[model samples]
Target: MPSGKGQGEPFKLEPFQKLFIRAVYEPQLKLRRVVRRAILSMARKNGKTALIAAIVLAHLVGPEAIVHGEIYSAANDRDQAAIVYKFARQMVDLDPELGQMIELVPSTKTMIARRTGSVYRAISAEAGTKHGYLPSLVIYDELAQAKNRDLYDVLDTSFGARDEPLFIVISTQSNDPEHIMSKLIDDGISGVDPAIVCHLYAADEECELGDEKQWHKANPALAKFRDYEDLATSIRKAIRMPAEEPKVRNLFLNQRVSPHASLISRAEWKACAGESKLQDGEEVYLSLDLSSTVDLTALMIGSVSDPCRIEPHFWKPRDKLIEHSSRDFGSGSHRYREWAEAGRLHDSPGKTINPEAVALFIAEMSQRYRIKGMAYDRWHMDYILREFDRIGLQAYEDCEKGGDGLRLVPWGQGYRDMGPAIDALELAVIERQLIHPNNPVLNWNMANAVATSDPAGNRKLDKDKARFRIDGAVALSMLLGLRARDRNIKPVDIEALIG
Candidate 1:
């Protein structure tokens, strides 16, 4: 409980605790910078919390401490935040000498030095909650589960103010690529750029994930404290679970399993690629990517079938080099009308469609079939949003609205949240819930689709820069919009609430 030496009291640090100390305070560490970022992926009972508490105490009470120093512990959940708090509390409870040196500030979840008034606090990762704080040191525990990326962004901004600020992000790798913790790991390993990152994951070769031996490599205290034997049994069941469920075990438990283990192979994906034919009584989902003068517009119609597939329903401007001929562009052509009338076509006309025209389109589609809500890229489709307001349509906004009718849908706000929206659409497709017409142009967009991951393990559509201009946002929005309309929900009134 009592961590660092308190008033000449006897003290000994754990191995990992000693490592944390050297990583942060060693003068040689500053000189070499051999490891600016490090991951300590120990097993569950490896005393990570206690070690972190000791480090926090070291920063607070160590001989070289700065007066009025500030330190923080951040986590994905409130419970995790409390772990750091509990650890600090334990240090005081175990040693009255240590307790005499520090005062617990109940109001702010902090431990304070009686002589200097330095402070340490615990924080949680909720929306718009992690700002306006500066700390000399930060310890992020169990970061792999962090759902919000904003917390990382806030800390990043704080780092620029002072070069000496110590930033430590630690976590058990989780399935979420979108999680702040996972992104840090991925960025550390990819070494795609100048930064050299450090990570000690279970070597895919050394241990069959879940094997106690394999898990121990990443965790130092596994032999004495971790429940590795029981975890091994669960790993087998996780491998057998469906696409999404098992990912949780693989990521957090450090198991090796493919979450997106598709029943269809690449060849099937290629063969099925534009071969989806619309049948009578089939419902189709439409995705629209609008364009301006330089950008090409796109619309995709995906199946609402068991194979859960998406293909392009339409594409624009056969070739960028070719002139905008009525024949090549197919503007005002019968083929365009055929799909347009079928309500399977999504169009973005290089600029925001006229408010009146969009309103008419939405209304017309709603009357024909359950026209679900539409999804558009908020970043690029500024004009479209204004048009929605001009027409008195409600869209979700994030703000302090005093009971205005505008309910802001938090999920529709950014590229980050768009990942979940796409996953939802994919699930709908796999469930055989969406239907669409097979259009040549739409097929083209689907063919060019690529996948990318952000630091937090979130999957995203990668629009190939060299190939055709494909807007997965547009496609995703169309699907979202359709789903929304079906649910009788309107886009949240972001302006009203956030403003």
Candidate 2:
């Protein structure tokens, strides 16, 4: 191993590095490698890339060497892939003894030890030519930045031929909680696989962001190899600009925080959680948000009286859940599955939401509770309206257009309507006038919501900017808007509305 601290000096392994090497090299009593896969997660400037380069070289021509051994350093892009390879080549060139033994091929980014018949190379996901290569040792550098799992799967599956294959992943925490790197970290934390070893250095969730102690916990080399002054400067900048806080925490604190700006404070949302169930005979207003057929469709019901109770019905395409559950960008579907199994979400059949099923659910809700009116967005109203028509429900015209009966109301999704609705809902939540059943699906959507302000200062939930589905939140806002209208109008005969 070569040191990054100085030129041509033997690398002095940190205590944590030594422990990792021991775990990988020291076989169990059964004479088998204890750890086949290792995941090392830490903040930047922690010598992660250099450490990974050293390990790659060790397997190439050191104690773990094998005849005709194939080792690779893989990353999301070509520049990232070259990082470890360049360091390894530099290490060998800096030392006379290692230089004499190894041959560096800069053009192809390869290092070959002719005597041992071992080779080290660098590859990236964009190359699209990773398949058909059997790798004995694989080092995935900055795996969090990878957009997909194609390269990861290719390299992982290619190792089955080797008797003692080793896969090492070194990366900083990703901003996306649903990313592949985050999934691996979650698995490592669970400790379900005996052959997998994980070392994660991160600040505690409750730790103050400005605390130096928390910074030291996440960055092991804070004052040493990593400059303390540089970090302090960044901390000061983050404090001055609220927009930079999430990026700083993700990169420096190694926390899996959401990259999206929050619409509501998490503390306030959690504070509003309580046991509030709706009664069968209670009069309720229904709101539906059908934004995407293949994505999430949300229906929210709220009681008319004080202590406004809410219940959410969420639907997603079942096939999409199966297709994306194992993907890196598919965290939403995985969570949906969990919520579905918990009986808090509904899984519609095929690749799109079943409008008939949604209509039937509304009919069932109408039978249980006296539904005053249902509010729906006008954009994708055709399918939903047809379903309602098939179910014998009348379409209510706009009150300004000479409408007097209770039916489905076409609610505009612009800033004018959503702005006031959001404000009212927020006030209700703060005043403890709005009660919910503490639904996890709805809670997740609320947490994923991000607010967007129009030029005139009106704000609404921005679906594009939200981290995940905000259909639930949008539905709730619509329900609040309908509730406002319900207070001014009289209820129509149930028989006439259903006919």
Candidate 3:
């Protein structure tokens, strides 16, 4: 007997639930959008479906609602769409009050409001299904897994017709930075809105990777629905030997797991550095890493003609890298700020650099050499995107969807394929197929890299995951692989493009 003043008792709201109700009903709230985003991040199995069902019932039966009102619940897959429908059905079955308010068409998995003639339908996101319906409210579930993402375009078109239409998108975090769900989460968190969006997420940066206590925060239902002790044991086993990437990321961190672990140790990766300068007639491929902190900004180039060989063209530590460091750097006793003042290395202009200046540098250098393509992680690299857009530089955007024209090479698979690439490079060096002018800084950076693997057997550098990272070693490898893949170079490319 859940306590409620209705014909059939209503479900009790949690602390977060009360907060969510206020977000939904209080139009006077100035920060309604912000509050809603917070609600979106509530842990899974915290009665999400029940809450949604209750909201639907109110819209259908409440006196203020419009007649023949349309509501839609959408998920990335048909199976997931059924889950929400099941909740609505269960509510109708359990509660005598809610049951009287609606007529369920069980065959179609739809609910029809008797007085208002409103309808609620469960929809799976398909290529163009959303285009035909003018829904008063639409729920997007598991948006991260949407196969085509055409639902976004259709929803955009439909939204213009209704003044007070409600849109809700909920999904677990996904690894693909390009995913539509991820974009929504990012936009919601940044307070970018015409649509009110909300997100709930694990505090990834603050939480220990495999700590069970921390895991429970993001998965509140672990004790009730899952075996908490078993989960803890599994996590412990994952990191114990070979350092499994999947169990660490997926189970604990709630991030997409990298597919494979590396054959080579991080220490071994650190030993594979070579020179930076390109030999005569050698075509180069560039990979860039834009600095977020006063971190290192690197541009690594690899020779495409000889798959086994790679070289670094640029490695500049932003003025901030060593600015606060307690360690001494050789005879140059002056601080990192001193290097910036002397114009020896580029310093961050302030919190960020002038996009135009950065663009000009890339474009100018690109023109000066026979570069195939520039590959970079777009995460936290918006400055680069804007700069490239402004400068008329050819860049790959929406590459997975075939809009960008430039080929997109995936990482994570790099570690698995690096051994072959390394062998090829070694052979190239012996055969004189590869040649370079030695650059000590590039060599130094390469000597500091580490490698790790995922369950799928893909491999990537552990530098991003490690406490100590090399200057630009990871970036160098990325550029080399990108160039090779772009050229359709055989036998030496990372397996991600093929498989």
The lDDT leader among the candidates is: 2
Query: Model 2's lDDT to the true fold?
Result: 0.78
Rank by TM-score, highest first. Answer: 2, 3, 1
Maximum-TM-score candidate: 2
The TM-score measured for candidate 3 stands at 0.52
Model 1, 293-398: lDDT tens per residue?
3345544444444443444433232233223322322222243334445554444343333434544444344344332224444444565466666766554543
Q: Write the per-residue lDDT of candidate 2 for residues 162-278, one digit (tens) a residue.
A: 988999998997765556688788898798987888888888764666899999888887876777988888887988987887777878888766676566555567677776788
Candidates in order: C-alpha RMSD to true structure: 17.8, 7.3, 17.3
Question: What's model 1's overall lDDT?
Answer: 0.52
State the C-alpha lDDT per candidate: 0.52, 0.78, 0.55
Each model's backbone clash number: 53, 0, 18
Report the Cα lDDT for residue 241, model 3. 57
